[model samples]
Target: MVNAPSGISGEASLEDRIARKARELGFVACGIASAAEDPVRAERLEQWLGEGHHGSMEWMETRLAHRRSPQGLWAAARSVIALGMSYAPAHDPFALEEVGDHARISVYAQGKDYHDVVKKRLKALARWLVAEQPGAQVKVFVDTAPVMEKPLGEAAGIGWQGKHTNLVSREHGSWLFLGAIYTTLDLAPAEPHRDSCGSCRACLDVCPTDAFPAPYRLDARRCISYLTIEHKGPVPEDLRAGLGNRIYGCDDCLAVCPWNKFASRAAAMQDFLPRPELVAPRLAELLALDDAGFRALFSGSPIKRIGRDRFVRNCLYAAGNSGDAALVGPCEALADDPDPVVADAARWALERLTSAP
Candidate 1:
């Protein structure tokens, strides 16, 4: 076990020691940043929400002050220890796009839930940091918290928020899962990473749904990941066909980033490895999953969060776009589902499939 240094002097040494410990605990990258509110980012967020970019996820509007500023989340926090774990895929995540009638789950959701995987490590690191500084209060956050992790990560030198509105690390590409440990300790901050995404509109151009209205800004309503995952009820009529075979979170933007050339195929953590069953799930099979079967298949994965109804709704959209006769029977069966939203999506999908040339 790597031990924290005794009587560590100066901020730089302590920062180094902490970063080393984070690496020892399996984090691919680690850094620290002052725990102050970022007015610039706050303004951007306010404008984005005002424009209804958040869509049905009204939670983004709640505790607006806290979501914009780390200080609002925890007044006592003097520094934020940002950490990242790589879930880089071996092959291009977009490679499976052409596989007709197969469901394309996001690269990140192909295995275990990242919140479960990242939070455990964050807690472990927070405990170590608390022990090292005695009396220093610490709180760890994953995606569940109101904390703005991406900006904090950029401030901590982990990466820059790319045009796609997600953190882009040169070393880890667009595949890093972020976590934070807010602490009262005044740890030395790392040099902030400058935006390296200049002139690269690959992420924006690649979005199937034109989710990015501008660089570094996303209108989540049109995002396939949002439509397929966060969205409840039937998807908008015009966008269902654009969903194609994506039945979970969409990775088109992330996968197209040029920085991903540096990403490794194998994830450092075993839990992030893709499950063979989820890699290219048959639309017919996925549409037929009942609550029990859905739970069993996605036992430890993030996909289970949306439940059977939403998942099947997404699958139906894919089936509608597939133009394959094999999936028509399943779509017809689900058109009469008990869940009104699923039934609606089924009918829409069936109509599209049956109408296809």
Candidate 2:
């Protein structure tokens, strides 16, 4: 193994210490990027934002300068340590879609929220860096921050962003959760990874909603993942049928990638293992969840963020498409739900059920 350069102390060279601690903390890959201007990246971000591709995620527009370039976040920051943790599932994620009566929650949201899991590890690494450097200042972030993690990961040599706009690692495929630690310590940077998605349009073609307007560009309004999970109000009628049983985020784009053949199931990270109930929950069962029931079911999972009303709204859409008259009772029950969004979706599902051939 290539060791850190001579004379570097405080456990070891920053890179060696970080790599060791990260491995102990369950990270699959770690890399460093020296803080510098990212003009081309800034331009691309500005263009994407100008095009309003972020949909209702208005926060993406608030910290334009800080998000596009790390130097803007912290003036003295010398390096950004990017980390990736694998959440690869043991079974094919797409297989769950065939179960007609069940809702297909995304694999990543099957267990404890990754933002919490990855953030804890990132903070641990940050703590180690502070202890080692004594005077070093560090700020750690998971997806909770305005940081452009994919681009930073690319600059740090973790992986290149695939056409689907997710970071794709050679070893972990597209099943990695990213986190970062910005520090005042100067660390040698790794060579950036090149995009290996050559000629593969599988991700784009597989989207049921045609979310991708072009390669490497996504229209969040048309994205099933965004429609089901991110959009708080009623889901658009046109996209509901295409959403099928996916009541949370959609994974068709990632599932179709050929690179996934090389992916390995993540080692037992308790936070990533699926709850038996969430694996293939019945649409009627999920639609029956009131506020308390929804809270109880998704207590530790990322799906909890959508809350009971939004979640039931999504389930209602799936119930409509399920074409199972059994689900019609649950859909009608929710038609008068207190939440307008839930009520509207239930009414729509009830209508679809009634009109079915």
lDDT of 1: 0.86
For residue 207, model 2's alpha carbon misses the true position, in angstroms, by 0.3
Model 2 Cα lDDT, one tens digit per residue, 185-247: 888888888889999999999999889999999899899889987898887778888998898
* TM-score for each model: 0.95, 0.95
Q: Which ten-residue region of model 2 has the weakest summed lDDT?
A: 1-10
Residue 120 local lDDT, model 2: 91
**Tens digits of per-residue lDDT for model 1 on 158-228?**
99999999999988889999999999998778788899998989999988888888898899899999998
Alpha-carbon shift of residue 293 in model 2 (angstroms): 0.8
How does candidate 2 fare on TM-score? 0.95
Q: What are the lDDT figures for the candidates, one per model? A: 0.86, 0.85
**Which candidate gets the maximum lDDT versus the true structure?**
1
Clashing pairs in 1: 90-265
Q: How many clashes in each structure?
A: 1, 0
